[model samples]
Target: MDAANLDRLVDTDRVHRSVYTDPAIFELEMERIWGRAWIFVGHESQVAEAGQYFATTIGRQPVMMTRDEAGGLHVLFNRCAHKGARLVGEGAGRADKAIRCCYHGWRFGLDGRLLSIPMADGYDGTRFGKGCPEADVQPLSRAESYRGFVFASLAAEGPGLVAWLGGAASSIDNMVDRAPGGDLEVTGGVLRFEHDSNWKFFVENLNDLMHPMVVHQSSSLTARDVAKAELGPEATMPPALQIIAPFTESYRFFDEMGLHAFEWGHGYSGGKTSIHAKYSDVPEYNAAMEAAYGPERVAEIFAVNRHNTVFYPSATIKGPIQTMRIVKPLAVDRTVIESWTFRLKGAPDELLRRSILYCNLINSSANLVGPDDQEAYRRQQQGLRAEGAEWVAMHRDLGREEDLGEGHLYAKGSSDLAFRNQFRAWKRYMAGVA
Candidate 1:
């Protein structure tokens, strides 16, 4: 699509249906947006040991992150240098010795340096020489880690990870601080789920606070009812129920909580308190945090609670609860979501257990919460296929977003400002502006 056509796909209040349903536009998004953006790859803890590797993708580029024998981290294309076959398998494992291609036995090091080729004496006189750059697996343009979270950008010429993260970087800080050692690791494996809708739909929903009450009403109320029945309808609601029950929060509560839109399409919602503050705190975990960071700093950290923070085009992080969900867009109508829970290093075991419970209850495929939103996304995808509807509305409090200076905007929680902010970032990316 041309620049003019891409520009017309999004407007101030709504976006054209083609952005979600058009195969051609999806390809462009993979190229222009995902290609250049600092896409979340995997956590450093996943590849903590030397020779360990985690395979993932940026846009359509099949890539993998590997830690070498010397403790260096490298993100390289997964394809083999010889015959274009994928070198490593698509998962995390120890690839420390050397990556030997299943096809033709071509060998490469953890850093993707070509190590050996069978019958090498036969190719000595050919154009494929020993030092040829094409003989080695290709690496991505840039790879960087913030705390333990690793990210890579396919485009070389862009802002560094810190510059790219901007205000959204604080979300990472909050997540790490939850651990007494101020660190974390992805534990308990990941729950992979797919959405039969546009990837943008999933990302936009991260900070779209207005949809929970409507779309998630069924599951939320059921969870609340179950908690009431079990807890005698008088006890404080359990944390597991609190996670799902909040979907039925009043409009006034959400509106007062506030939505923050940050640069490069990153933002967050429901920042009034930590996601767990509603139920109660884990005493052991609280004591650990106080000991590590002292009373004032711990209180300050706890005060900056945000429910959902969007690192646009890739992942949504719930820092306070220590869980994250990443969107991997496979096709125009298909998207895969990988939900992960973290163990805050040095914190109590109960804290980690709570995070795991939250992940299983709300983020997992069989959860009571995810299905409700998934149903809406699937139905919306099917419905948008009709020729009748030409646009998707994002007009809630459209003109009321308050300027918060420094490329940030404050919108009432019920506002669709997050979607508008994302589309504006989308337009910039599609136009190759940054």
Candidate 2:
């Protein structure tokens, strides 16, 4: 696409519907954006031992995260050097000493070096010699960890992980600090769910401050009613109510707090009220955090409430409950969401349970709040196939952005700055500029 056409395709506020519906644009996104960005992998705690490993995908490439004998982490492609069969199956497993491909008995070390192959004498003098670099399993271009979470970049060049993360790094730091030991563990099993819409729909929705109250009205209202019934008419807000309260939170509240957009399309809706205050019913969790972080730091940590922080092309970190939802794109219009709940390494067990419960209630496939939003996204993808409208409206607070250094901007919560910022990064990546 030419510059004029690309400019017309996207605007400052809203993007063209075709950006969401067109298959061609989706292909371009996969090649230019997801191919180069530092996408999130599983947490380090998931594979803590020497032989433990977890299999994941980066862009369209199948990759594995394994812990070597020296207790270091390695992220490598899953294919074997010989015969091209995957060395390990889908899902997490133990590699023991090395990954043995079931197809040809090709053994590879934890770091993906070729260890041995059965019947090796057949090609000793040929190009498939033991010393050939092609015989070793291919490793990713870059692998790095921030705190305990691991991420990998498929391309050899681009911004480093830290530079790419930018503003979103605070979200991860806040999460780790919530734990008494200043660390987190991936304790609960992942909750995988499929959406019938494009992956971008989910990413865009992360910074959508308006939808929670209206789209999730049924659940929010139900929670409100339950809170009232359980505590009586004069009773205050409850923990369960806070769980769904963001939906009913006033637009003014969002507008004042605003959203912050960073480089590479990463953005987050900021200015969240403390959910802990509403949770007088759950004194156990409050006390646990307070005891772990002490009264001052605990208050500070809880006070930095954020709705959802986007990690660009792949994941959303929900800090309040220590929940992370990783996006795996299956197709232009289909995506798989893997939800992982974390435990504060030194916190109480009840706190961990609370995080799991929130995951089930809000992020799970069976959630009452989630289906409504998914239905809207499905219809959006279907409706955008029309020929009438050429542009999507993102005109909210256009000239009102407060510029932060290093290509970051901030605007009111009601502004479309997040969407606008995303398309800017999208254009840069698609044009091979960033």
Number of backbone collisions per candidate, in order?
0, 5
Q: Which candidate gets the maximum lDDT versus the true structure?
A: 1
TM of each candidate vs. truth: 0.97, 0.94
**Per-residue CA lDDT of candidate 1, range 1-434, in tens?**
89998888789998998899999999989989999999999999999998899998887789999998899999999998888998777778886689889989988889888888888898888888457888988899999999989999999888899988888898899899878987898886789998889898888877878777888878897778878888887788766777778778877877777899988999998676533457577888888899999999999888877878999989789988899999899999999999998989999888788888888888898898888888888888988888977999999887898997888799888899899999989999999987
The C-alpha local distance difference test score for the whole of candidate 1 amounts to 0.87
Q: Model 1 — TM-score against the truth?
A: 0.97
What is the lDDT of every predicted structure here? Answer: 0.87, 0.81
lDDT by residue for model 2 over 1-434, one digit each (tens)?
65666667765666787778778878878887888888898899989898888998987789999998999898999898888888787678898898888988888889787888788899877988476889988889999999988999888998888889997898898888878777889975788889888998888887877676688778787788777788897876554566776566677866766798898889877745533224443466567777776789877887787768898889889786789999998887888988889998767787787787788888898876778888888988787787887667778778899998777788888888887787888878877777
Q: Ten-residue segment with the worst summed lDDT in candidate 1?
A: 270-279
